[model samples]
Target: MEQNYLAPAETMQIHELLNFKTICMTSSKMMEGVVFDQELKTLFEKDVRQSITAINDLQVLLGKAPKLR
Candidate 1:
């Protein structure tokens, strides 16, 4: 199997993306409870789902990065 590793800069970028996605997901979930418009609620739901997928993908990439000493 071929080895896959991320450079330090790439690793940092991934970490930032992961954090941003998590925040977005949390915000969407919270807004879902108070939103009165059906269309808006649906949009938030979709965002939450997409964020979850992005976060998972980011986690997998982060796991492949080399550990810092």
Candidate 2:
């Protein structure tokens, strides 16, 4: 199977995205604990789940990046 490698720039972008998603997920999880409204809490939970999925996808793409010496 042929593998497509990511350019250095793309790799960096994915890293940044992973960091951002992680921050967002963490904040949402923290907020869920303090939120009084069930609807808002549910929304936060949904965001966290979606962030996890996105982070997984980004990691897969990052794996394709060439190793830097």
Candidate 3:
């Protein structure tokens, strides 16, 4: 049976994965514009897309994050 809510440990793991994926996506996006080689730029674009997909999936598992207020 699948649980609707993640366990605390699992939630933490998902949170960390989300953070890592976001960093990777941001870095790839930053490099894509400045990159001189066409192939390298394409590679960065692919990475950025993949990272975004992963981040979205992880966020789904994490549910709504907390607000400071």
Candidate 4:
């Protein structure tokens, strides 16, 4: 993968995405504690997995640091 350095705007956007992803992932995890229904718990777990994937992808982008126009 081409690891381009992130421009200032791109870096800021990535920072925002990272923060959002963190909140989403953390909320999903915390929800597991209160969720009693199996189906809902499963849903929460799925969301957590998705959030993790998204965060991972975002992290990769952050590492690559694309300067998208």
lDDT of 3 by residue, 1-69 (tens): 754656677778888888989999999999998999999999999999999899888877777444336
lDDT of 2 by residue, 1-69 (tens): 987999988999999999999999999999999999999999999999999999999999989999878
TM-score, one value per model: 0.92, 0.93, 0.83, 0.81
Per residue, candidate 1 scores C-alpha lDDT tens digits across 1-67 of 9988999899999999999999999999999999999999999999999999999999999998998
lDDT of 4 by residue, 29-67 (tens): 999999999999999999999999998988887886654
Colliding pairs, model 1 = none
Which structure among the candidates has the greatest TM-score? 2
**Lowest-lDDT window of 10 residues in candidate 2?**
1-10
Model 3: how far residue 4 lies from native, Å: 2.9
Q: Could you list the CA RMSD of all candidates, in the order they appear?
A: 1.2, 1.2, 3.6, 4.3
Better of 1 and 2 by TM-score: 2
Candidate 4: give the clashing pairs: none
Off by over 4 Å in 3: 1-3, 64-69
Which has the higher TM-score value, candidate number 2 or candidate number 3? 2
lDDT of each structure?
A: 0.96, 0.96, 0.84, 0.88
